[model samples]
Target: MKIFNTPSNSSTISGFLLLGFPCSRKGQILLFVLFSAVYLLTLMGNGSIICAVRWDQRLHTPMYILLANFSFLEIWYVTSTVPNMLANFLSDNKFISFSGCFLQFYFFFSLGCTECFFLAVMAFDRYLAICRPLRYPTIMTRCLCTNLVINCWVTGFLWFLIPIIITSQMTFCGSKIIDHFLCDPGPLLALTCKKSPVTELAFSTLTLVPIMILFLFIMGSYALVLRAVLRVPSAAGRRKAFSTCGSHLAVVSLFYGSVLVMYASPASEHKAAMQKIVTLFYSVVTPLLNPVIYSLRNKDMKKAMQKILGM
Candidate 1:
């Protein structure tokens, strides 16, 4: 590995200047209240899931273990964006320093990638439980579960590091004003003055590989699960099996579908709004809905909740 010199001068970042909705005071206030409420609900919902999982012994299986991890990650995911967004909404200058922007991207991308990998892992766990129930205990052993969780975070962290380093190296001599409420890779790349063909290639490769690999793994897992579901003798057994897998499949579809739309779509001038809306799905709305989706559909989760709440 080649060593790079660290710049001695403390890089000055003017902080991020968020260009939130409508450039007016009233607009900012209204937006702030709305996002704040969303933020509160995201925290409360994900937090409750984590607490319930930890408190209830019945929820100690691999599936709920990963759900608890998802709840925790969703809390941080919202924290990474919502607070800064609210601040940007109220402030006169939404200017973020170059360093601050990269830092934000690093954490945001890390958590986002982690969620993707965790979701895939959760799907595989479900597949094992439903399709291979006889070996579920041995298949998802304690050591294997620990390794799987660690690998997800480690892989996600590594994947985001490339973008952060490449983006950091590029000079930002041009306009610092980013259009979106938060710093995104698409907009940040657009802002750089330095030539980044190599960086762009690297970013694309990094983004594509895990997505392709995970997509195939998820598909294969679901295929086997479906095959197993169909072979069950009783209708009630099939329904129970399908019910367990449906929520995981739904959450996965929502996540990957929105992401593919956002990044893979054309980069025309009009697509900025489309990109923002897609980003909102994964970053804000998805996190809020994940716990709700998992809780409402799963009978075990409902019973666990009832026990946790002393109902």
Candidate 2:
């Protein structure tokens, strides 16, 4: 198959050809089916959590409220890319218009940023609830919880705006064919008319710095929660405390573990297959697992899910 479109002399291209998982027809169909199943499961799982949190009066606490919002975010987060990806899997001409590609880039990264902030905020909520039990109710009031949720959405959407605009404005030329599935910074930058080292550095810094900072904040909060949990005299109390945190911690590990590997180094250094695999893991797999982790680890959530399922 022809890779480049006759070496366009123009500085910018109208759209990009996404070389999404170049494989036989059978492979594409199989992948389409597999990813379609995963996407549906992700939506159902996260949606169920949101429903459970909404209907279950027992889950009206600050932690569960935050969880509901997180689940809602996960719905959008996975939706941002999966449908397009699924479409690409089946299309002979896997093309994405410039505006559509950058919009995906913006929402994908912005939702990811929101997830980071939400995770940190959730960790802080757990810390307050476990380490400062007396102050938890008063400190994590409904109004405060609402404000934090708003702040996460607002800040996350705004965080990557400038970088995305900068990247989108850069001159893109040549083949106009992205080697991987999505319009990622690495593949996008590689398509630029001129190699701008400075722009690449700025994008990487913008992506990784916030992630590292939020990760550290989460770790610090959890450290305090761990200390406090350890001091509880009763084994049952300690068990309760750990159980409360285990779900969030599992989610944190899954998300950050994959994300750090994907973004910690220069994107150019990553092999295309590795990049696709890692991105698929965090973007697709992690969201599907989050609701399962939360439900299985929390008795209240499990009961609420059972109630929702009428089991």
| Top candidate when judged by TM-score against the true structure | 2
Candidate 1 lDDT for residue 86: 88
Could you tell me which 10 consecutive residues in candidate 1 have the lowest summed lDDT? 1-10
State TM-scores per candidate. 0.91, 0.96
lDDT per residue (tens digit) for residues 15-114 in model 1: 4455656556887899899989999999988887888889888888788888998889889988888898888788887766656677788999889888
Candidate 2 lDDT, 1-311, residue by residue in tens: 21223236654578898887899999999999999999999999999999999999999999999999999999999999989989988889898988888999999999999999999999999999998899888999999999999999999999999889889878877778998778888899998887888888898898888899999999999999999998999999999999999999999999999999999987868999999999989998999999999999999999999999999
Which residue pairs overlap in candidate 2's backbone?
none
What is the TM-score of candidate 2? 0.96
Candidate 2 has its poorest 10 consecutive residues by lDDT at: 1-10
lDDT of 2 at 150: 99
Per-model lDDT: 0.80, 0.92
Count of backbone collisions in candidate 2: 0
lDDT of 1: 0.80
Instruction: At residue 231, give the lDDT of candidate 1.
Output: 96
